[model samples]
Target: MTDSGALQKFLDGVVVDAAVFSLRPDYRAVLLPVDGLVPGPSDEASEALLQAAEASAREALAGRTVEDLPHVVAWREAYKSFGAKPQRTRNSLEALLRRAEAGLPRVNRLTDLYNAVSVLHQVPLGGEDLTGYVGAPRLVRATGAESFDTVAGGVPVVEHPDAGEVIWCDDAGVTCRRWNWRQGRRTHLTDDTTTALFIFDALEPMSDEALQTAADDLAAHLLRLGPDVRIVRRLIANDMTHPEGT
Candidate 1:
């Protein structure tokens, strides 16, 4: 990896400063490709696809959002969940993949950077748009229709009742997160993200080798973007031990 002046420091911060989250015992690690783009699964092909996706994501973002959940179900039927009900915006979080494959656009370097990584890794990522949390930044689950009001345009609703997990930021109920496979229109990444939480999700905890590669690759990618970037690892949890606990 070529060094790009202050980029080394930025790479350090992006990997070190931010916290990371893992899936709950209830959820299983599943390899989710960029939605709509992920081909049907075959054990052999799925593994290769996942690896390739991870490589791409690392190339662009030097970070990733661990993706879990297979599907959402209610009564006896299953439906797609996009963190919010009624569809907040026209953009599908999956669009990031398509965009990345086409090269990034210039809309605030950070935003483009995040999308690049999101697409490369084939994982859905979410974060603060530089405006702190409007509600709470908690990774909670969807209970029912009455529990999902953050992005419903004032419409009270519930998130996915089965499978899948979501980031239930308290600031806005469920403002910005990857629920059921798409990003919310409410809180998106913006140009002004000085301090933000970068998410990395997976069906299972990454092997140490994979983690190291992820770290190295991400750092390399960040170096290419410019400089003065900081990346640290942050873990968010509620055990009283705190996430960065001993």
Candidate 2:
């Protein structure tokens, strides 16, 4: 388990810049720093969760397209506000939903579990290796100078976000680009990850009550991943931070 003080300090450093809030005043993010996870390759349990999520996605899209969902529409507008073409640069939620129609990726135990939660709850969720982070996480509009490590044409390369692009970063450049569109390679979760940071992005049409329900479900499932799983969460909105339990 992480030291309580250290974990609190890390959470304290999480912030959403005023520029980002100015772009979308309705934005809210739930940051969860969890520890004591039991990580491994995906097994029967995780596969079952993925199957259930696929069914949920199919049910949601039964008579409608992915773009017809209100939450997805809000996210698309959010992307366009920052000069991104939503169709070309799809947000994580939309991408997941589109793929979930066929099936969700089974990366590993840790990632598979969160992906399932994301699809089941209809939220854009991101998970990172807590230990890989050089500093705490923050959301800001990029200046087009930060280095984002990613693969291009099957080769490792560094890329930079366009100026005014919304991004999640720390002292070590960008961690995620275009809001929740894509996560950098630096802090991605792995099969051995035991400590992780999860980002849940929300906007209008998704109430705080609903977001809390999703978080509650994810936490309940995570508790079964390990005997000593420990979790600390906070909600950041309107430039203010509230500890999970007050």
In the order shown, what is each candidate's alpha-carbon RMSD? Answer: 12.5, 2.2
lDDT of 1: 0.37
Best by TM-score: 2
> What would the per-residue lDDT of candidate 2 be over residues 117-138, giving only the tens digit for each residue?
9999999999999988887898
Where model 2 places Cα greater than 4 Å from the true spot, the runs are 239-246
* Candidate 1 C-alpha lDDT tens digits along 1-246: 122323233323321111222323322122111101111212343333334654564464435421211111120011123233422221223444434444444444444444445445443344444234453244544443313333455764445333243434443455533433444444555444444444544322333244334444444544443354444443323233233431
Q: What's the CA error at residue 185 for candidate 2, in Å?
A: 0.9
Q: Which ten residues in a row have the lowest lDDT in candidate 2?
A: 237-246
lDDT of 2 at 122: 94
Q: How much is the lDDT of residue 74 in candidate 1? A: 21
